[model samples]
Target chain A: MLDQKAHKPHERLAAHLKDDLSQVDEMIRARMASEHAPRIPEVTAHLVDAGGKRLRPMLTLASARLCGYEGGHHIHLATAVEFIHTATLLHDDVVDESGQRRGRPTANLLWDNKSSVLVGDYLFARSFQLMTEADSLRVLQVLSNASATITEGEVLQLTAAQDLGTTEDTYFKVVRGKTAALFAAATEVGGILAGVSEDRIKALHDYGDALGIAFQVVDDLLDFWGGDATGKNIGDDFRERKLTLPIIKAIARGDDEERAFWKRTLEKNDQRDGDLERALEIMTAHGALDDTRAAALDWAARAKACLDALPEDPIRDMLSDIADYVVARLN
Target chain B: MLDQKAHKPHERLAAHLKDDLSQVDEMIRARMASEHAPRIPEVTAHLVDAGGKRLRPMLTLASARLCGYEGGHHIHLATAVEFIHTATLLHDDVVDESGQRRGRPTANLLWDNKSSVLVGDYLFARSFQLMTEADSLRVLQVLSNASATITEGEVLQLTAAQDLGTTEDTYFKVVRGKTAALFAAATEVGGILAGVSEDRIKALHDYGDALGIAFQVVDDLLDFWGGDATGKNIGDDFRERKLTLPIIKAIARGDDEERAFWKRTLEKNDQRDGDLERALEIMTAHGALDDTRAAALDWAARAKACLDALPEDPIRDMLSDIADYVVARLN
Candidate 1:
């Protein structure tokens, strides 16, 4: 079954960069340990061991290798990327009050909100320490800026959560900050560490940015797609009163009755039974899901097109395949 | 009144570094502003404008100036230090469930925990961006390590809260992490950016660490000293079940009855009307407050002594005065 999964683009990239990935893992384990705070490791181990796809770090590894870089700093960079992702997830769980993540009880749920917040902070510091070791001022700038962007996006999402007036522009801005910023930084720093040209580096950034936007759109669509495919309960977004792309589109095209339903369920958060079903119906009636899927496909195509600027290599092809794979679920 | 306040050592340092301090303020206001997320600045302004003395940034500026260094990077470093301090305060309020800080309602209270957490994260990222602009990898390493230490200390404090078994060693470790790490980093990074000798940098680190320990010990002592001098209600730490030095000392020396009282009040968190009085009486009987005061003075003296290694500048004198002023309240 594991070998069969290897046919996936990200998995193929992982197979190609097996040694570097292991080194990244080793560095993550080594750095996450704290002599004073045993709780830090216990909380982090629960999250890291749950085995998310490690998609962000894999992007960094693939990008660097695709540019023909042969040095250990890429490992540090990759590990740093993963650490940032983990840190954000830990904090996000607390912010979202999420009970489960990656199919396991979240750190916030298992330990407490205090542990999640502080441990998330610790991971962020660790990520910076790793990035500093890579000795690239430019990489530090990119990652730190991305960090700021991610947090800003999260804050925007929080403020926009139940507002029926949330625009698609605001939705895109939030997605760019919370998701694409890190993804773009992850790949851009790889090209940067490899001493690639400005054009190629920009191309890598564009690819990652588009891929991340696509990934998040697909995720939001999956939340309303009514399936067990994403390992999440369908309508979780509606239950949480989140303002994602589909809901935003539906609101834009909604009738007065539909608008009243959204205001009662989302804006006012007086959700009743069958509210999720009603939301899905309204979204489908407005063709919001179809438009959202079209947006995801558009981003995926843009991501694949950006890869054309990179040198022809197996890693590049895998990256292109990864872009396609991100939206493949929608098909 | 302002001039009278200026006689305070930290105020004296601020007066001395007026130009640079203004520049730090300017940088802080500039960087804290988010183009997309208006809430980020709104939450940050509530905390930043509350005006908590800005001691950490003053340390960074004082260290650099005392080294006779001529550079603009110190402003960035000082701003970064302030940002880091602000970030921690935001997160700390959430973890402590604090309603007020610096005699003002905390950001977490004014907004929410989610806002505080995400905005705190934004400030941290902003701090890193500021640090990278200073362009010294060694400085980054010291500051990032301090960041890790600070978070670890906070987590340890959380795990150790209300536990009767928390040792003095554990107490010191927690204090070192949550308080001294940032202090040490703030000062050490100044020296590092100034291109000072390793020996002088070590001295700066020691000065900041000792000063921070003294500051925290004094704050904790003020909590039980039964006065409004600290702008906090007496026995707040007791109500929160925080095992500070005085309580840790009292617990170690308590008789069976006293031990049971502590276990019931602290460990079990069962308290009645006279519990605070009883707790204070037990601490007084055991000379815990006296001993804790002595500990603060000792650390203050050590902080002052570390400054002797630097050149005899007015800034150095101000630094020594700051150390002495930290513990002078105990008298």
Candidate 2:
């Protein structure tokens, strides 16, 4: 994990999404600045300019292009999907009472919770408008379905917080609803708008869903085990009392004493200094991190395999590479 | 202002939206309950079962039916629109820090703000899912645009809360975004789904817009002149420091001293008992209330007039009667 090597993973990933990523970026900049409600430009620009990896929109763009979508509406569909994703993130911070995001002060922290909520809402609405421009009922259907899944996912996560009994089944449901649903929809609509066959659409959807699951799984894993000082904040998930996969695995493997320790720390969200060390010791002793990484790799492999049914193209090749790149950086 | 007379007006309004209203009630009850999240059902039921006049959804249904729509999707569209509106109200009460809604405790009052916000988001998602079932690009456009407008309207209201210089134009814009946009979309979608002529669809849209404007205008007037001990609190608007039409008009007509008094009380959003009385007196002296009433009547007239272009039928006739009834109850 040298500094240069540490950045190699992101660079390699960017190389895969290169062209479609650029298109999604350009479309996002164009669509984010609507003429109505001058405030839209101001509020949207604040977050949009902050620079995201554009990972979700790229999935959509690549998916559609890979499926032979020569039409431009896919651009609109891609950007719309991204906006919906971003809007949810904004409102989520406020609801979670979170103060930081992507290593910066959150929108709620900078202004107030009210602005974050309303602006998040505005962005959501704007995304809908973007989808409307696609002029395909099926495309709208795909995107709105994703939007609903995203919201329901968030609600499940909210209600599930700090509840130790949150099972692996529910965790997957929450992750699918909150994250993978949009990823799948974004790519699925791309194929759909291209008027691709149902099989290809399903293939792209499976690819995106598996990739998203892998992405989130890796994120959860890093929060617990990424050893570099960079992502060493493994204790926040326990501190927040979130029911992540590693913790679920650990709990399932716990003895009576270990179970009591988990209840006192993660379930109660009260951790002492020695708790992280203790938790890490128990996780390694129980092979939790190893199991979690293996699961992420499994999802990533499934994602790559889903692309096998699609027609061959540079875009398809890149999407397969992107799938591998999703969890490649995970130790 | 008596409970007996209040029922007369409410019953008239309710009957106007009767068929559509009942359908919305059934749809709402069915959708809010899901097997996966029992808690979601409980939280949602608290808000949904606590009935407010289902005016917004009824507008969608009545408008669709009035526009001669024959499709089944409109039902889902109407209900989806309503779920979104309810979700916003749940969030709004939390933001506004209000305690009462429809003569009962607000959602935020009953539960914590956290529950209100998260549950509100869940309903928003459910609404999106319902509308996506319509599978119409045009329908998605109308609904998504309305969603964005609603958010922008709310934010405008938030920023403009106590600004004494709030213009009639801004007020109208806010009201349109907040209320009329959805109303217009509700009816407009009916014509779109019915495969009607574009001009007829536009006419339906205009009809809904005028009716919604009139509805909101009358609402503001009632807030000022309607007495307490019945019909909810009259001075709540004044107390909240909201700059509604009557006050905005009165401010325009004020002398220098009167202007300063507004700056202190209205802008400050703090007023003694005398201040409300004095503000009412000033508004009356300048005929602002009458001016507002006249404007509302004009809108109602325009709304009824839009029906002339519609095909002659009993439904159309009832719609015309409904428009008249919206403002007639004010008198």
Candidate 3:
């Protein structure tokens, strides 16, 4: 087993890529500024400088380094990925009416929804401009297509919310759209910029996709797992009526009474004081939480396996550890 | 003089490029479809089919045709431009909390702000994808830069709204961002796709920029010009407290009393019934309205002058006539 007391995978990766990460920070700061509208920078800086781990951009940097890339465009792609992420966070907070994000007041709350909306748009446009500067049509295609998928996923999540008919298939689609698309694109573009072979690029894409899925599944799991150290409260997703994986699994295996319970709590948004405990009891009784945990582990394993196709570099090892580290919170 | 009864310039352009326009329509319908999210197409179709003149896309088509070039990619660029416009309209309604657009209930009003915001994002991403299909880095740069400028302008407008300190320079920047950036990009990309020379491209760019400026100036003027055939009501800008061209001019020319009225009406947004009339009277008394009209005419003339650089074709004549038609309402 790895030394858990040692530096975390992302921290080690950040150390190794210290220069590149700093360059990315520089690029993000430079690009987010607006000559005409100071609000663009204000709203963007609030989110971009929020203490969230720069995991996505790190993935790009790590992937490019692992693929033997020595060029600077990876920095551009990494900054672009972060910009897209920041933009989406701004918009998502508005959509979810979220007051806080990354333990800070969201841009939507700090400013108004209008600032969040318009500033999100500005960042998106900025991202588009940055990606085009990469000057690779393939890179443009990968990023642009991922962007479409991400937005499509958000829309699907919106429509699928509070609907008990949301299948596991639809759940995966939403997860892919909301989380995995950019992750995959982030890694895939790194490989592309490195002039790596198609197979290697595919492997990187698969690795990022699996890693993202595992990351989100753990996130959803932790939301209900309660009392974990992730700073998320128990049953927050439940309060929001989000139809996540465990609930979807529970709904599928639920007895008539259990299904009715879900319907009342989720579909109808009618929850009594004891409903959270009862819902957890039902989920545990049906092994739904266990199954969700298993699915997350499987994805994490798949992510690690995809890394084997890359060269045996320290970066690759860190990437594998990152996958494990994502699901390790469950332990 | 041409027979005004025969057809509007846009109508003539539309008739001339009916096949291209229809192809653009087909592409828009096809591309706007979301395999998972039906709401995307539903919201998109509502705006796309709202029977507003497809003026921007037609500019793209006419520019390409006038450049003596033939290609299918122009259709893609045109559709991409339209998608950008539609996406902006969606977000604008949400930002403005508007209930109506193009004489139809807005997507934000019909569905919700969430739908409008997410669907608009989806359309923006879709536009990004379509523009990449044109397979030119330069095209990507142009469209992406325009997208950035457009969003920047919007954020500026959001911040600049109701501020009496907004200058003519700031007003033009806002106008470029909100309206003219896409217009210039649309026409510029047509010449780009035609593989035209640098001077021709510059001419196309200038023509589009001036035309867009004129188009928006006329739009702003009409919002307060009060009673023409256009469906817009007078003083909409005043009611919204938006700082448009005429108001900027009027504010610059206003004395201390006039400034107080504007500060009360626009800055503080406190108004009784006659405030709109008083605002108009102040504007007319200062010749702000007339100067605004003259400015619009200057831009229209500039747009027509730019057309002189391109080869003489039926489309060229139509474009010049279109410029004239844009400001013809002032007569």
Candidate 4:
């Protein structure tokens, strides 16, 4: 369904989550307005107005609804989570000195690092404000823990950027910190806000966590293979020396010469025209891509398994579909 | 009492906030630990281990306790607030390209902007976690609002740097954003946690806001007239072309030639040897320093007045003394 691509993945999610998404957007626009600085809106609009999957917030809404949350606060919490996500992006652009995000000039590149950094801070503050509105201590704890995890993920990515020896364990930790923690927090907070049972909450948390990991794995996969839809270069991850699952698997299967090539490119960041193609060939021959696809599918299955414990509802069905959608990206 | 050699203002507040201070320290240490990235711990330790005033956390603790809070989470909330403060400092040093803070090498200078930015993100995440521990959406709202205010204040300061026309109104707005908002949040969260009446909560917030304004104004005044014990260079504000209350007031009093001279030194940043002295002369001649001190004292009085409506306790006395202490640095 996501592959039909007459509409975008995020747009599809937004359509299913239309009412919830509209509510979230209005809330975000209202909150982003600041009496103190005019420049704040300018910087925030660059990212907030930019089209994103809204995957994080949707995970939040879907999780809460699946758990039978009837309260209105979950929307606020979802927006809060999205704000944190956007704030991190602003800072990430500044730190990475990236020229593009989703094929657009990053706020840092368009404005300046100083604006990016400070405005990112502003959004973070706004997020905290939104999260604070929930009034639930458990919700606060879940979201905050997710935030810390996200930062740890970013820090891990920072040093892992050029390092070749970065193991799969470290990469997993990074994925958990950067991507999955928020997913866990977003969904976990949903259950907490709903005041659902701990067992079901755990199930939802696992679902979100697994889905986040699976989604990120696919994202890494697409960073190397997403030429048509995402416009990502095949060697994007290679250029960054990202040390994704496929690369790690490829190295495990490599001979000494192949290993040396991997070492020179990843460690030294030395690249040639054919290096990306060579790496892809090695990965294909070693079945690394197959393994990665399998792993993503496994996570998708795990996310679905989490629903076995949640209430049977329309929201639950969509969540299961989302799990499948995450894996389908690799196909 | 504030001017006495043995009884410093901070010392009084420290004594008043002894219990809360210990709690804040414990919380800070506990939160700064990270399992995955050892670098996070190392970088966080550089600042958390460094003995600063613990003033921000103290504000949080005191604000809560003074409002009749008997719970434990205020300590966590206070630490979260302080972490936000420290994270901003880490980022600020990078943007300012500053070297020393409180006589220690800044994180950016000691490590790098990469580490600084990433670690700052880590702390920010950690803080969100801590605030969430408070579990009150109201507490989160106060803390987040303060965080946004702080960011706005910092940005305003950045953009306003070297712009000599930045008015007293703008100066206060900037200081309010950067410094007072956190103080108000610290206090406001305290009231929220205590379940105190909204009126008293507003009072605590006002107390914090006015006290913070007073404290920062005193800080600006001390930067020009304060001795070595003040720990900042006299006229350092002028050298940096920072538009402080003194400079803002001085510009209002300057004639055409003086305005041109002030512009050259401040707006153009073409200062020479004795320019600081001339700037100080302008500040003194127009009673800018005197006016700033008077304004600070007025705010301190207002801060103290806010407490009059509260129950009588040593902490209350201590809070008032803290206000007096902010303006006492000139002694």
lDDT of 3 by residue, B17-84 (tens): 88898999999999999998888998889998895799999989988888876778988899999999
Over the stretch A184-301, how does candidate 1's per-residue lDDT look in tens digits? 9999999999999999999999999999999999999999885576778898888888899999999999989999999999988899888898898999999999999999999999
lDDT per residue (tens digit) for residues A184-220 in model 2: 9988988898888899899989988998899888888
Q: What is the full ranking by DockQ, best candidate first?
A: 1, 3, 4, 2
Model 3 misplaced stretches (Cα beyond 4 Å): A1-6, A227-230, B1-6, B98-111, B227-230
The candidate maximizing lDDT is 1
| Model 3: per-residue Cα lDDT at residue A102 | 82
Clashing pairs in 4: A132-B137, A135-B137, A137-B135, A140-B132
TM values, all candidates: 0.96, 0.90, 0.96, 0.89
Which tens-of-lDDT digit does each residue in B195-292 have in candidate 1?
Answer: 88889999999999999999999999999995577889999999989999999999999999999999999988889999999999999999999999
Regions more than 4 Å wrong, model 4: A1-12, A272-274, A311-314, B1-6, B12-20, B63-70, B98-111, B191-200, B269-274
Candidate no. 2 TM-score = 0.90
The better candidate by lDDT, 3 or 4, is 3
**Every prediction: chain A TM-score:** 0.98, 0.88, 0.97, 0.94
DockQ of each: 0.77, 0.49, 0.74, 0.57
Off by over 4 Å in 2: A1-23, A34-36, A98-111, A227-232, B1-23, B227-232, B329-331
Q: Among all windows of ten consecutive residues in candidate 4 chain A, which has the lowest summed lDDT?
A: A1-10
